[model samples]
Target chain A: MTQQHKHIISMLVEDEPGVMTRISGLFARRGFNIDTITVGKTQTPKVSKIVITVKGDDRTVEQIEKQVNKLVDVFKTIEMKDDESVTRELCLVKVSLSNEKAKTDIMHYAQVYKAPIVDITPKSAIIQLVGKPQKNDAFLELMKPYGIKDISRTGTTAIQRGGNGEK
Target chain B: MKGSEAIVKTLIGSGVHTTFGFPGGAVIPLFDEFLRFEGKIKNILVRHEQGAAHAADGYARASGKPGICIATSGPGATNLVTGIMTAYMDSSPIIAFGGQVSMSLIGNDAFQEADMMGITLPITKHSFQIKKANDVVPTILKAFRISAEGRPGPVYIDLPKDCQVGEVTKEAPKKVDIPSFKPVYRGNINQIKKAADMILAAERPVVIAGGGTIIANAAKEVTVLMDTFMIPTATTIMGKGIIPEDHPLAIGQVGMHGRKAANYAVINADLVMAVGCRFSDRITGNTSSYAEKAKVIHIDIDAAEIGKNIEVDVPIVGDSKSVLSDLIVVMNEKLKKKTETEWSKRMKELNQLCRCNMDSKKEPIEPKKLLFELNRILKTDDIVVTGVGQHQMFATHFIDRMKPRTFITSGGAGTMGFGLPAAMGAKVAVPDTNVFDIDGDGSFLMNIQELATLKEENIKVIPVVFNNSYLGMVRQWLEIYYSKRYSQVKLGRHSDFVKIAEAFGLGGIRVEKPAKIQDALKESIRSKETMVLDVYVEPESNILPMLPPGGHLKEAFGGCMNAKGVFF
Candidate 1:
């Protein structure tokens, strides 16, 4: 039997119109579900990096990687292994300041997690959190008791740990 | 120069002698330029845009050049979707051009405007929309390059009406630069060496080839490798003619309706070397039980296809022709030729068993018997194209294609209307070669309008229709799986096909009896004009040696269905 696990796939693609659609369309067409995806320009002006996370058996994930690599716009596709890469996700959470005790508890949790309070109003406070997706998930869970109002997240993005940064 | 003239000049400059297209409002400027440069390119006007697309696909499959098809935007471009998908699935090279409305009115959904690039993106290798007159030459040239290179497929170009009418000064580029689209042609030396060693060690080895063999022109290389090692071979329908069916080691095609010997060979082989073939589900029914004993070595030009369908022990990514050449060299260096083995003897016995009732003399002609007659009549190099149905399977069973590109069909897409126009396109590509479309009543009617195109173009080809009066393949499945609870599969015989052919200004022959099939075929071939032979065949007959849907290879059934509705 094969085991299913999360796979972080990164690609260097041409910075052209519809490149994102081409990438996402391929995943949809091939029936590979994307758990989360993030894209941004690389150091090279003409190149963009796309990071996608999908959960599948190793074989299916490998097939997805090969299929994505076949697109003409893609230059390279690599699996960003958890051990050899640093993955980060930025999330913003808005929490309701229900009471003095609730606000103090929320501030204590934010400090412990190193999440800075970016905005504070009379009734609500917006905290910015940057960490691994799982750590952010834990942070969201802690803020739930403080009456979480809304949330925004930039999905997981990754780079290799050392000097070679996805050439 | 006008952009229309630039487009025409680029086509001529790219060594395109013929193109299939239909004129409409958006493409008037482009159509006018065909008259301006009269003798340089032959523009064959087709009845429908779908016909244009299929004709182009057929031409590409036959001539190994990228087939060109042009259509106006909106409905015309949308009509081409099926044919483009057919070419896309089979990896046949075709360049499809759709004339859009003016650039300014693109987003407004102007009359006769369509998003050709957006529509064709999933089906084509690449697509481009020319933004201005100056971009026409370069984009068209790039489309041609992309279509024919690597694993060849359709490439679509959206030509706005303004771009076609506007003036252009730019010259055609000397070379196209696509930095991210390089295709690997040569296999890794280490992998090639490993494959050769594996072949040498195995006692029961089978080579399964597919459409990529024909696309790469690697039939000779494949044949040489199998012959040198005394290996029996089977082919997918797409790879039908890659190996001459008459060869001693050939076990015939392997699939749902494949030969028993071929399926048996694949199931029992200790080593399976799949060359230029994607293991489609039809080829490997019930994947868990398919070739469970075989150590598979898959070779294909596309890395994505290597393990897309089936797992492999060794995967070599390279063009079939190049990889096979290297494998042949490496194998010959360290090995001595082995004579006929026990496996070959068993293959011969199985083949003989499979041929028991193929020559049956029945009243309403047996499907296999009709093909047996066709097998006797057709020349080795004569091209035979078939639409999807019972007749196509019968052709696959009995057609003895001795050359590459001789047996063309919509293998992946299974498009019903592909035969007639595709045959016409093959004839256009190789005018001297005799081309024939072996079709069914159901499949023939789907593209019957192409008969007008045939009459107009004066393209000489023969069409043999097995008039079963029903969607025979679907009806057979209904009978088998649904306990004979038939549905809308019956296409009642209401119209006279022979009269229909005559109405199109072509000679028509009707063959009702088994004995008349030969003379009807002979007369059609002897006649210089296009002829249609409407051969009325056994209506209730089902294709045999069929593996029940999702059934294992070892469980495939042959012979007739019994009174209890079970195949014996």
Candidate 2:
């Protein structure tokens, strides 16, 4: 039986044309299905930090990391696991509340989950939550009985919990 | 002018209305400008940059328009690679734009500083990196032109963050000039005459069409020639729908899983006209022995493709549509009827012989029956996409494509998830067209995440999975050659595909009974959302009429009836 585990990978690459095509081609051809990926600029100019979250076995992760590093633009690749890293995901949940009583009940539930009411209307309210995927999932599950209308989630973004600068 | 504004104008001028992308810091300026263009352009914000790339590919295949995708620097840019390669392999026109680091820090290993150009050189048709803001417009225009013209494929343009923020004169180049970018459009007249004479004089002549016909839009011209000459035609998997399958001259696909008559005819032909096809190993079993008795006349847009695999007696490098048109005209002028009624009768007899062998009652399920049922239930205009491997060959062999643009599958790259996403793209392109993805269980799971996208888009496609619980084609190879060690071939745990479909908020049905396939397919087609028909086929069942790899095409195995009348 193949064991499934999640890994967080961070890559530093040269900003150039068709870089994405090369990276994604490697994954697709190699048959590695990526779960989530987040990209943003770093503090240094011309450099960007890419956070990729993938669910696969240890061998698959190792192969992906090695192959990704072989790309011309890639400078480095670091894999972060749950125990070794800090991760967070943002979620916006729009819930339907027919009356004042339901809105009050929903707000009460949100407060217990540490979610903030970002926006409120007569018929519904949008609650903002930020935490690990599991935490967000649990909160969403708890609020499911309250008639959830829609949910938009930003896939996991992570950084090393304690900076050791191993690289 | 901001780099984003220039990019938008270039796309609009190039006739692009839709784009898929995910924005990041380096690309914020472009996305901001995108908002200002609002109604002029439509952007689909995908969950991931990779998804955006695939979505653009989907859009392009369906619309026959160049699909555009954008991504920020580093990871965002890297994510688009797979989709670009997918487009490249399938000859789908696409333009991908990525954010890059500023020119000053380009080689300094600055944040997100990765050499995208070098990485994508082998895969992309063309790639450009903008050093100056003024170059963006011309670069984009060139990329578009290169992507859409002749043997369409993916092109890329990288814009530095500083360039996006810089000012430039609003002058867009009216034309692009490239010295080495000429594509041949007309066939050589002498070669055309020689091929025509051979076809008219030969006792048996067969035409093998490939994806190049679709790329050249030469289906009509090909049909005209076939009908005029009363010649039989066969297609590669990518060549499906190039010739209407119901046409009397059509012989279905030719390959390992090709029809018995098509394979037999190819071996027996006196002259073979191969048009716009690369003659992949799958099509030509053994390069040296393929069409050993026949004189081959090969016409293709890419000169490199000719004589690369199989040597040709007559080679013409030009566009398929134009070459075929010239051939038709020449044939009409120079040719007289050379009737091969005897040869036709013999071929028909062999076809009948092959048909009888497939009717064995000992097998638990007949693949041909499944295909027949699917063909019966599917609409004439509905699109069918398949994953690569045995199932793909089976679908090509059995399914009759009656219309153009009704079959979408990966022929070059042979990517697995291609079926589901390509079908989605086809459905999105023609909302009214019923699209179905015929896949195997091993292939279906590759990009099953698209189920979420399908659900979100409310796009319905019927996914008929040939669930034999093994990598059917590879297992066939191992069984035939490697003594069937069965290393990682069997899917040990039965996948609850129906349950998985339900989890994705789509309808699902498990077909254990073969009789209910037609009804299940009909219902799935009529449904409002995506549906998965998990079919439980026999694990050890192999596609018959197998041509051993690296062996002569004529020396095909299986599809033979023993003395007891049992098909082996």
Candidate 3:
């Protein structure tokens, strides 16, 4: 079997209704595993940027990119290399305080991670962090022992790490 | 002008003179517009919306123009899904218009409303929902352009009730520009040169023409290449009729249930130039073993299809006619002489050795015999459309189609019930040509409801039904692959098709003996009205030279057999 890796594919697509489904449905129909997908309006008024992270072998990923590019609404598709691209995720975690000592420890750890407390209650505090997905994962691991109440995450979105922009 | 009127005008302006449709509540306003423009556009009302879609697909395949179909909302639109997918799989150019509830009631679970855009998005080349009246003309025009351009496929436009009734003010665009959807029409010069070099160096070369050849109208170019190079040629099922079956260089249809000579040539050839073919599994059985000895050159308009199924040594992405024309020019300049080589002699011997006995004096008629008789009487201009089944395979094996777009079948989707309506669509497109629907009992019954449409519309289509009263193909599979433990394969003698045909006020005949087959076909052809000839074939007969599903093409068995029960 060929070696498989998590691939990040970014695309510029027409801002048309059902364009997202057209893109995502292709992956589903082809049975490719999509790890995460993020979409937002681009600077161009009638276009949108979509970042999709999928797990597949090299050949399959190449095929997926070609198939995605074939969609009528898609303008272009490019692979965002890990070493040459900036990738980030936003994660919000609500941790149960339980005690003052625990709360101080959590706050200290939050400050070290540069994660700010966005909401606070007598029993819980919501820590909001925007960083690389691995960093957010590490923070979540540290909060596991504090009796975490809940967590929400925005899937990883990426851009090229250079002076030039993708057309 | 109203939005519906603008739509009618746009369709007429686009050179669409015929459309197939079934009306319902949501499309009442649009149907009224069709009424007002009755002379300008002839809308044939089909029994079912699915029939409408298939008929349009058939029209497109026959006429080489974009076919149009319409249906009401919800169930009506949903019924078109199968036919739309069929056209999509075959890459036929068709535009389907579906009605939707009023825009205000769209998301509120309005009566007779369905998410047509969502339902058909995956199956269509593109789909649009007319949000307002102003968008109607442009959307319809764009739909036609998109469906007919770039590899050609079905495009859908959903019309809401308000949009149909609303006023249109803006002028329709004279041309459509889609930035994201450009198709490459000329192959890379370097690649074309490489392909020419390969052809020159090849000791044995074979050409596999496909549906793309017909779409590109590259049959003449393919013929020139074959004659110039003295190469044997084979065609995929969709590619049938591109080359005359009786041409000395022709090796017949290639793939599962294909001719022995065709499969044998591909297996042994040193160079395989596949033009306008996607190498579907039906064509390239056991992909790992397919064309193992050949350095494959694949030329197609769709780049994605080139490498999707089979690996190619020389990949040329362009229109087949354009690419072949360039390749021919390069070859012509480089060639010193053209003569029949040892490879061509071997191919001729192989073709001669693969002939089967089509004349049997048995009581029950063999399906092959029926097709042989049909072939004798069929004019070069006559068209034969088939449903998917054993009869389709027999027709593929026996029928001799001498022109492009002469043999139409549901190749990719293999949709049964495609014959009747598709034949109707073809007859509509070419009234002067004789259109025959060669169907099986199992397949013909699937869309027998179209007999009424034939009677009312006066479309003269001869339905040559091979009525064995069994799903013969599946039964063959059961006998060979399974333990002959037939399960639900038999549709016992319950329905009388002659009575059924007469019920629709059409002519019908049942031919139980071999001698009556030719006369029945002749009678049907002579009649001005539609006639159904339900032929009783050998009950347990099977279509052979069969490659078991996923088996190597070279290993195809059971066409030529002696008393010893061994293949040649």
Q: In angstroms, give how far residue B469 of model 1 lies from its true place.
A: 0.5
User: How does each model score on TM-score?
Assistant: 0.97, 0.73, 0.96
Candidate 3 docking classification: medium
Candidate 1 chain B, run of 10 with poorest lDDT:
B559-568
Ranking by TM-score: 1, 3, 2
Against the reference, the lDDT scores of all candidates come to 0.89, 0.78, 0.90
- lDDT leaderboard ranking: 3, 1, 2
Estimate, for each residue in A1-167, the C-alpha lDDT of model 3 and write its tens digit: 78989899999999998898998888888888889999999999999999999988887888898788778889999999999999999999999999998899999999999999999999999999999889999999999999999999888999998784888
The prediction achieving the highest TM-score against the true structure is 1
Candidate 1 TM-score over all chains jointly: 0.97
Model 2 has fnat of 0.00
For model 1, state the Cα shift of residue B215 in Å.
1.0
Per-residue alpha-carbon lDDT of model 3 for B534-556, expressed as tens digits? 88888888898899889888678
Clashes of each: 0, 20, 0
Better of 1 and 3 by DockQ: 1
lDDT of 1 by residue, B288-348 (tens): 8889999999999999999888889999999999999999989889876767889877776
Best of the candidates, lDDT: 3
The iRMS of the candidates, in order, is: 0.9, 11.5, 1.1
When candidate 1 is compared with the true two-chain complex, its DockQ is: 0.73
